[model samples]
Target: MKLLVVEDEKKLLENVAAFLERKGFLVDTAQDAEDGLDLALERNYDCIILDVILPGMGGYEFCRFLREEIGSDVPIIIITALGEIDSRIEGLKIGADDYLPKPFDLRELEARVRALIRRNQLRSEPVIRYGPLTYDSRSGVFSCSKKELSLTSRESSILELFLRNPGTVFSREEITDKIWETGFESRSNIVDVYIRYIRRKLEAAGILDIIQTVPRKGYGLRRLRDDG
Candidate 1:
């Protein structure tokens, strides 16, 4: 498994990264949230170890941005000196999967990381097949008729949402809410644009009319013929 540790404390960061590396995990370290965000966007890690206090863009904001703005679901464990109930609640409430107070044992932290990753794994369906389209959640790969289908990150996320909910129709606004942060322009036609992109890709793969559009409603994935 892979992990990212973002801590401003020089010694603590080095020690944690070394320990995780020794534990057979590919560990990446960052001293601040900005660099942490860069690494996060660049690579997919099984879990992230974050520190609350930092030089710029505190951990809380970083977590929020990762979840809301970037639409990431990677598990986060916040390590902070604030051990109060309120602080813990705020951490989870803002998208952290787990929290650990500073001065914590390295073993317990490892346990928490493993548990969170295990829980996330159990919560996901390994492979979802709808008609000729198949999605592997673990690999984040989509295949049509046993052939790999290439998709951009945002496009894949949108298609994954539809595949997971087979019969549910997602209105434009609903898709926007689920995919983009609240600050996105309400009048933007990005949702429709993305739907068009996805449809074109599916069509190129010989999967036609998979994305059904309701007149006044929005879009949904409907089974075609006996492809299911």
Candidate 2:
């Protein structure tokens, strides 16, 4: 899972980021609300840990902008020192899914994050089907021809992207940005390497022509026939 932590306290930010990273989550941190807003707008995240007290744009305003302006349904958890009823009400009224007060337990925070993600996943389409292949979002399982395809995390992420947007060509840069949250190295061949891995697995499963290379452009999923 991916998360964005927006906290002004440098030590707290680093601690939270490090803790979450150790928990196997791809975490990005912002010292202030502006940077957090920018990151939230630019990338996709399973959940956002927003600080209510910020330098310029406060968490309440940011949450409102994220929900009202950007129309993002990504779950948001507002963290604040103010734990009063009114404060919690304001956070929820503005569109935060959950609220955590200052000096909260990391384990509880992690549990809340997982619960929100699970609820969101339940609301979304769990399985995406293209021909005989199926991508199960809940389990991170990809299967073809009734056989489960063993995929590394990167391979599964790329395949899920293609399956979700069939026929839309994705440039290597786009893939790298989405898959590798941190920017890719200029000389990195990771994208091509993973594409080859996915293709090999698909071929082995008797699935063909699903992922197509657009000449000098990028890669895309071929439109599957209704009967395919």
Candidate 3:
């Protein structure tokens, strides 16, 4: 599975990322909320590890915006030093699926991730029809007609989000936050860069271009009918 770690502490970020990576997860990270939010929104991940307190936009706002505003259902695990009752309530109320207080056990964190993934996996049928593709979000697997292929972590995240909420127009800012978690550190042309990468991969596999551009806006993942 793929995960994003959004912690401001440089040492902690690397430490967590390393542990997760060692456990066979493809992991990425951000130093602060801005960077984390950008990466979270821009790319796709199986789970996001968000710090509650962050610079630019705080962790609470970032998590809230993602669920309430962007409508991303990507599982969230809030990680922070604040471990009070109210904090946990607030985090859960806003949309985090799980919460882990800092100074936590790495093994516990890994267990939580596996549990969440297992829970999510049980929610899916064998296949979900999204456009021409049949997606098994749980397995990170996709097939269409006679074609079958495994998806990369980034590919799975984008596809999963698109399938969950069909016909939604996603802004680059929105995409950046949802997928990559680099909301506030964008230096221009970055969103386009990833979009192009996604497009190339789909095309390389002979899949139709379901990701459509919106000129000055961002892109939308479309479910084109058999005729359309």
RMSD of each: 15.9, 8.2, 11.8
Full ranking by lDDT: 1, 2, 3
Q: Which candidate has the top score in lDDT?
A: 1
Candidate 3 structure quality by residue, lDDT tens digits, 14-107: 9899988766577988878778778877898888888998877888998898998989888889888996899999999999999998889987
Write the residue-wise lDDT of candidate 1 on 64-126 in tens digits.
999999999999999999979999999999999999998999988887887787667647678
Compared with the true structure, what per-residue lDDT tens digits does model 2 show for residues 20-139? Answer: 776557899999989998899899999999999999989999999999998999999999999799999999998999999999888778778867976786578798788889888888
Q: Residue 183 in candidate 1 has what lDDT?
A: 45
Model 3, 164: alpha-carbon shift in Å? 16
Candidate 2 or 1, higher lDDT: 1
Error of 2 at 95 (Å): 0.6
- lDDT score of residue 115 within candidate 2: 76
**Ranking 2 against 3 by TM-score, winner:** 2
Judged by whole-model lDDT over C-alpha atoms, candidate 2 comes out at 0.86
Which regions of candidate 1 are displaced past 4 Å? 127-228
Query: Model 2 — TM-score against the truth?
Result: 0.60
- Candidate 3 stretches greater than 4 Å from native: 125-228
Each candidate's TM vs. the true structure? 0.56, 0.60, 0.56
